[model samples]
Target: MIYCCNDHVELALDVIVDEYETFPVLRKLKEEEKMSTACEYCRKEAEYMVEN
Candidate 1:
């Protein structure tokens, strides 16, 4: 998923390497560079939430 609020946008979820290319979340991740970074960051956050 992706969250956009005018000033900035962020990745709301993580995606696999292969899923990156066709992930629904990445479709609106904002920038091309930020896309990957967002995915990684969101992935960690997601894991933390799930683990707990």
Candidate 2:
């Protein structure tokens, strides 16, 4: 799974599709869940989880 901020969500989606060759699942993070996660493409707090 890739953790991403709003700005990099599209990039994360592209990565999942390119690497897995399937549609990705995108989930918004809960407020508590956002505490320790960071975006894969940047240092911002992650707002979503992207996976296939």
Candidate 3:
């Protein structure tokens, strides 16, 4: 899965599709489940999880 911020969500989606050759699932992080993980493409805190 790729963790990304709003600004990079599109890039994350493209990566998932190019690598997996299938549609990706995008999920927003719940407030109670927020983590310290940074965006896969940038230094901002991740707000969503992108996966197959």
Candidate 4:
């Protein structure tokens, strides 16, 4: 799942890996080399990063 921002806006949630490529923003995420992830509920930094 990918959050639109740290403010708890979700771009995708509970998605399969195959579905990732369908999201243009997720693709942009890879090109930009950004792997920022956070909790949608608590708004805290995630325990670990999720690489694209």
TM-score of each: 0.19, 0.97, 0.88, 0.23
Tell me, by TM-score, which candidate is best: 2
| Candidate 3 per-residue C-alpha lDDT over 3-47 given as tens digits, one digit per residue, 9 for 90 to 100 | 999999999999999999999999999875456778878878899
The segments of candidate 2 whose C-alpha lies over 4 angstroms from its true place after superposition are none
Runs of candidate 3 exceeding 4 Å displacement:
none
Q: Taking the tens digit of each residue's C-alpha lDDT, what string does model 1 give over 1-52? A: 3333222322333333234554343332334534444223333212211010
CA lDDT, every model vs. true structure: 0.31, 0.96, 0.91, 0.40
**Clash number for candidate 1:** 0
RMSD of each candidate?
Answer: 11.9, 0.5, 1.1, 8.5
Candidate 1: what lDDT? 0.31
Which candidate comes out best when scored by lDDT?
A: 2
- The candidate, 1 or 4, that scores higher on lDDT is 4
Error of 1 at 36 (Å): 27
Comparing 2 and 4 on lDDT, the stronger one: 2
**Candidate 3 displacement at residue 17 in angstroms:** 0.4
State the weakest 10-residue window (summed lDDT) of model 2: 34-43
lDDT score of model 4? 0.40
